[model samples]
Target: MNIVVCMKQVPDTTEVKIDPVTGTLIREGIPSIINPDDKSGLEAALVLKERVGAKVTVLSMGPPQADLALREALAMGADEAVLLSDRAFGGADTWATSTTIAAALRKLGFDLIICGRQAIDGDTAQVGPQIAEHLSLPQVSYVSELELAGDSVVVKRTFEDGYQRIKVKLPCLLTTLKDMNSPRYMSVAGIFDAYKKDVQVWGLADIVVDEANIGLKGSPTRVKKSFTKGAKSAGKVYEVDPKEGARIIVEALKEKFVI
Candidate 1:
């Protein structure tokens, strides 16, 4: 089986701080990590590799620094890694990002493509489906479990209420949920091997991308503004008996039309 895993490097949102005065994200001291759900997709790919002797390739589109994320995927047993990085690819919304990835996949053919349900930084959950749209391939999003069965793969697709078991043929795409599988930690030997491996970096020249849809020029959505919700200051503090508290809560609910 030939599998391609899409991965991303994102700032650790937990460590992300916002400036009070500037009302902007403080990225200076933030550390970057592989987007968690994307790692789950990699883990799923690795499992597929073990099950059917598949060769796994990792692909990511980001700045040149994103090569680090690809190398890390290599350390996790991916056969090859490709980084799509170019100035033209900068400031891309998910539409542009998925377009670039779809182009890259055309250059690197695959029997299956796996991606995360969503990136942590942008929880829009649009890129995977967008890639499927761009590639004109069938896709199953939010797959929690899967198994290989002859020529087709059976997937347990997840939903808010429950999950459905469906079989999809090869040349299909899947967006994996966090519970898809357990991601393995890189071994000492694997970590050392990653440094010795070479990750292929591709620019705009390497992939067949529509110039109008490659970057910010093609993105229709842009954050007009980003600001953290300011914390509410101290509210009214009333010392009262349990019965009085209950009455106050009921009145407050009625006032807010939440009753």
Candidate 2:
């Protein structure tokens, strides 16, 4: 089986900062790492690879710095890696992003495609399902467990209160959560080999992408404005007897219909 895993290079959340002037995330100087849930997705693919002799390919789209994430994937045992980078691919919304990725997948081919449930920075959780739509393939989201069943695959998906088991045929997409599996560590040899391995870089010219279906022009969504929420105001402090304070609280609650 051949598996395709979509990974992303995201700013480390803990160190992420907001630019006061632009009201946007300040990615400059922030360390970038593989999205956590995407790591989970990668782990799932790697597990299948070890068990069933599957070949895993890691795909990511970002600036040139994203090559680091691809290298990490290679160290984690992915058979191949591809980085889609170009100025034309910048400022892409989920729709355009997924479209570009789907185009790449069309070129590479796949028996199964796995992606993280959501990206931390975007938190849209739309790309995986959108890619499925673009590829015209069946999709299962929030998958926490998976197992091979002959020609088909079985998955356990998370829901509101619990999870349900689902069986789907090959050539399907699954968006995995962090509960899927633990990511493996990179070994010394793996790290060295990662540098030796070739990572294919593609741009608009490399893929058969329609000019109207990539980057900002193809994206209908626009960011009108972005800003951080103001800090909460301090509550009123009453200097009165305990009983009087209780009475005031009750009266305020009643006025607000909290009673």
Best by lDDT: 2
Model 2 — which ten-residue stretch has the worst lDDT? 18-27
Q: What number of backbone clashes does candidate 1 have, counting pairs of residues 3 or more apart or in separate chains?
A: 0
Candidate 1 off by > 4 Å: 250-259
Query: What is the alpha-carbon lDDT of model 2 when measured against the actual structure?
Result: 0.93
Error of 2 at 25 (Å): 3.0
TM-score of 1: 0.94
Q: CA shift at 46, candidate 1, in angstroms?
A: 0.5
Candidate 2: how many backbone clashes? 0
TM-score: model 2 vs. ground truth: 0.91
Q: What are the lDDT scores of the predictions, listed in order?
A: 0.91, 0.93
In model 2, which runs have C-alpha deviations exceeding 4 angstroms? 19-24, 237-259
> Total clashing residue pairs per candidate?
0, 0
lDDT of 1 by residue, 159-251 (tens): 889989999998899998887678998878888888998899999999998889979998988879777899679989889999999999999
List the lowest-lDDT window of 10 residues for candidate 1.
Answer: 223-232
